[model samples]
Target: MGLNKITGILPHENTCADLVPMAYFYDVLKNIQKVEEDIINMTYEDGRQPLLVHLDMLLTIARKYPNTAAMCIYELKRKHLKDTFEAWWERNQKKIPKKYRTGIRQNADELFDELFAIKSWAKSE
Candidate 1:
């Protein structure tokens, strides 16, 4: 269905509205990759590779957060993100609090992994 690439949302705005539409876009990305994989069927140059639709955007954020290792291009990577749960908690436990962490289950890696998977769609952040 034409990949249905109607629009994209700010990945990390996390506002009520910004997040809602992203779910649909991810689905579209998955389907397009699937179809492309079947058509090319080449391991060396597979459809599994996601093209950066907007080079300018990627370059902008890339320079802004030169060392950013966030999952997505537009999402700004935090500077103090830690790798171990203990380390992260040491830094955040006070601000976020242990009581709040009581029933939570993710380790630092998993937590940060999903923390900024998406990025702001705004021209500048």
Candidate 2:
């Protein structure tokens, strides 16, 4: 995606329209999931850190749009299923050198599982 397209999707940090409707927010979530999948599937030697970065970005976006039902369900499931993994990821980041973190990054397959589960939960309403 182009930089302009990305900027168009996300709101300004302090905007009054922060809570976009559930449908609109789901669209953004879907795109973020697609980008995350691409990052995970990237096979180059330097792909993992970028993948983690994208995952972090997606988390941040979810937080920003917390009022949306789809985002809410996604976040709740994420907190339940991956909260420990996320904490581990953060702890490891501080404990391990940045160079070594990539080797221990979350796998693409696991990410797909979580993403699909969240998608399913979001659609159940």
Candidate 3:
């Protein structure tokens, strides 16, 4: 999906209630990546072909993180959020596709899980 399509799903910023819902939108993106990686490695087929749903979800997730990160920076301006996010963004820039680089971030926990799974699978085979 395109950036505009996913951003349209974000809640209207008229009420305080929008905060949690917007955050949950990112959470759904995270979960989609989780399942995507699971499917990629577990499905017995051509590895080159990615699931279309996963690709759509990834683009959505990629498109949403900047807003999420910016919100995080605002909420935790006094904390290390800005610096930490910058560092993460810089370090992982190459790993993320160009579409996601502008907005969304890679979910660290999901990345780690995928790495561990790949490692374990490699050892087993």
What lDDT would each prediction earn against the true structure? 0.37, 0.46, 0.40
lDDT-superior candidate, 1 or 3: 3
For 9-124, candidate 1 gives per-residue lDDT tens digits of: 54443334444444434444354344334334433232112222222233334444433323233333222222222333444445544564543434334444443444545465
Tens digit of per-residue lDDT, candidate 3, span 1-125: 43233225445443454466456545654654454444434442322223334434433533454354333322222123224334444554666667755444444434333322221112222
Better of 1 and 2 by TM-score: 2
The residue-by-residue lDDT of candidate 2 on 14-115, one tens digit each, is 344444455455654565555444433443233234444444445445445544534455443344334434543553465556676555554533553544
Alpha-carbon error at 87 in model 2, in Å? Answer: 20
Off by over 4 Å in 3: 1-11, 20-24, 44-52, 61-66, 69-125
Q: Highest TM-score among the candidates is held by which one?
A: 2
Residue 85 error, candidate 2, Å: 12
Which pairs clash inside model 3? 62-104
Clash pairs of candidate 1? 11-119
TM-score, structure 1 vs. true = 0.24
What value does the lDDT take at residue 58 in candidate 1?
39
